[model samples]
Structures are given as structure tokens and as C-alpha cells.
Target: MWPQEVLALSRRWLLVTLRERLNLLFSVLQPAVWLVFFAGAMGGAVDSRVVGTGDYIAFAVPGVIAFTVVGNGVTAAMPLLFDKETGYLDKLLSMPIRRSSLIVSRFVFQTVMNAAQVLVILLVALALGVRPASGAAGMLVILVATGLLTLALTAAAMALACAVPSHGTFFAITGFASLPLLFMSNAFVPLSAMPGWMEAVARVNPLTHAIEAMRLLVLHGWSGGVPASLGVLVLAASLLLVLGSWQFARQTAERIA
Candidate 1:
């Protein structure tokens, strides 16, 4: 990959994200809002032991972070679709830069943006009387897991962007997929609390592994499950990165041809 081109494009997109102040504010706030309200509503009703945390807020914090990654990472391709519509993508295609740089830059931009959002959510969680049981070291593990999950989601979204004919269709597909994935995971509750079938689904869900990893860190410190969860994320991210890169390269070639 062309590192310079990737960095340049990543920086350009980051600036655009910053310029859209309202969108940026909402992106950060939405997760925080969900963490606060969702936790408050469920805290008293749900048993803390069932949720696998001291309180619902603590349990929901990682869930909120994971969902934020889903929300932002899945829409990471919107700008690419806009570029395609405006002929900017064609211009980039005509340039000497590596085609993979486009995908890399998108990954970089989404990862950074999600990181910032996660930071806000963590601060909000802290204010709500949550603390990471494993301290700063566990917090770092949470970030790493979150980053891998972001990479996988963003890569898959960009691959879909290349596959779909329009941005509207992309939105439709991702919108349909995100919420179901959230509900199927052990994000808000422990797997033991889920129905048999949903529990089975959650067992295999990549998002579940990521959230569980974060939950383990936040509520229980390091555990044996952390490696397995991180492994799942790493595998998913690697495979999706390859798929996305290939899809983008093929699309570029076809457009050029």
C-alpha cells in the first residue's frame, strides 16, 4: 500500500469529519445518551448478577461502545459512495496512487473516529459510577478489542459499498443488519440470561466476543476468555480486510477497463 497516499486521504477525511461539527457531536453523544438512559431504564429492573456486572450501567457501557462501532463503522462507506456519485472516485482511479490506499484510508479514518467516540463513552461510564476492574491495563485491552471490531466492520461495509449499486441500498442493508446483530449478542446481558437459540447465536457472534472481552476487562479484569475473544476479532478483521481490498481493487479495475 502507498502509505503517504493513505495518510493523506485519511487526514482529508478526518478534517471533513471535524468540519461536520453537528454530526461529530451527535456521533459522540448518541452512544453516551444510550449508555445513560438505557442503563437507567434497565438498572433497577434487571438483576446485576444476570447482567454480569455490578450494575446495569457498567454492563451497558461496553455494549454502547460496541454499538457505536457498529453504527459508525457500518456507515464508513458513505463518503466513498458520495465520491463515486460525484466522479471524485473516478478521478482517484485515474491517479497513480495504489487502489488499496482508498480502503486503508477509510479503515484508518473509521478506527480513529470510533476510538474518539469510545473515549467519550468511557468517560460517561466513569461518571455513572463505573470503573474498570483491571484498571488501565484492562482499558487498553478493551481499546484493542474495540479497534479490531471496528476494522472488521468497516472492511465489511466498504466491501458492501463496492458490491452495491447505490448508497441508499447500502444504508438499507446495513440498517437491517446492525440492530439484529446487536440483539443477538451478549452485549446488554449475559449469555446465560438469553434463550437457548439466542444464546447459541451469541456464542458465535463476533460482536459478542468483542463485548464479552470488554465486559471481562471492565467487570472482572483479565481472564482466559480474553485471548479467545481477541482471536475471533483478529481473524474476522484480517479476513474482511482481505475481502474488502480485493473487492475495491476489482471494482477499480472494472471501472478503469
Candidate 2:
């Protein structure tokens, strides 16, 4: 029953996203632009000695992949906000479906969308001569890391959506949060390149771990920290999912009250 409900809801959301052609185009395009322009422009300026590789494209690919997760995950809650405004969320809650289905379905849909975007980014990077050192296995690890990170972020977004009073506030908060997180992490630059304070902060950033795991896979194949990085992501995702589910139920209860 749970699986059926989740699948039905996920399918609906997926179709809605697909039908928005411009959204799909920009979703891929934003990251592609970063990969091409930002990476290209800055690649030359970066000292190859810092990253231990001459190819700045390769160094930056993991960061771009992480950026894709951040970009997609932060916006995952917009649909929920729209539904809330339209009262569709209330109507759905009135149905006999499991309450948890709402959150699960969103997570599933966002995970798929984020994965697709990441795949497109990787393919484009490959076309431009970037190859993962671990080959297919490395790519699989990247996808797994991406999935876990997206799940955590998507769940966080859903919780924010339920907590916030309006779509405008949600957008403002997410936008505020995303950029700092991106720049502070090792996504675009090595920790060695950052000042002491920023490096310390980046060390604690979850995105840093995820990006490092991916960098290790892409640049050096499997390594020691891969398991730890992935484990942290899985744990984070589980906790966030539970929190998001709780918030979702609370929101529904408030609607009924």
C-alpha cells in the first residue's frame, strides 16, 4: 500500500516536471554553464600544484556535481508551496492515502530529477575530456553520493516548506542558504587554497565530504574516506527524512485543526 501510494504520487510529480520544458532546460543548462564558463575561466588561474592535476575541468567536475544537488534540492519544496497556496495539499490530505506518502513521493521524485541532472553534467564533462579514474565503478559511487545528498536536501526543503508561511519566504531562505554553502565548501577550490577560517568551516560542511568522496573516486579511484563520507550522507538523509515527515504530519494536523 505504501509503495503503491508513493509510486502514484511520484509519477504525477515527475510528469508535471517533465511537462515544464523550460524548467527542464534550465535545470540542465545552469550547471552546464557553470561547467563550461566558470570552470573554463578559472581553470587556468588555479595552480595545478594545488589540486595535483593539470586538468581543472576534472577538479571542478565534482564540485559542479555537488552544485547540481544543491540547486535542485533547495527548490524541491516549491511544488509543495504551490499546492499549499492552491489548497490542493488539503484536498490530498483528505484522501485515504498514507500521510507519509506525501514526503516519500517528493523525495523520490526529486532524487530522480537530481540524478538525471547530475548524469547530464557528467556526460558533458566527459565529452569535454574529463574521465573518472575509477571508470564505471567510480561513476556508480558518485551517483550514490549524489542520491544520498539529494535525499537529505530534499527532505530539508520539504520541512522548510511546511514550516514557512509562504512561497516567497521559502525562496528567500533557500536562496540565502545555498550560495554560502556552495562557496564555503571545497566545490570550486581546494581547502588548501582557502584561508584558515573558511577552510575550517569547509571541513565541517557536509557538501565538502560528499564532494571529496566524489573527487577521490573521479581522480584517484577508491580510497579510505569514501565509506565514511557515504555513511555520513546516508545518516543525514535518514534523519532529515524523519524530520520532514514529522513536519509534514504537523502541517496536516494544523490544517485539520
Which candidate comes out best when scored by lDDT? 2
lDDT computed for candidate 1: 0.86
Q: Candidate 1 lDDT, tens digit per residue, 179-240? A: 98998998888889899999999888889989988988888888898898889889878998
Which parts of model 1 have CA positions greater than 4 angstroms off? none
User: Candidate 2's residue-wise lDDT over 143-217, tens digit each?
Assistant: 999998888888888899999999889989998999999899999888998999999999878889889999988
In terms of TM-score, how similar is model 2 to the real structure?
0.95
TM-score of each: 0.96, 0.95
Residue-level lDDT for 82 in candidate 1: 83
Q: Assess the local accuracy of residue 8 in candidate 1 as a C-alpha lDDT between 0 and 100.
A: 96
| lDDT of the structure predicted as candidate 2 | 0.88
Worst 10 residues of 2 by lDDT: 229-238
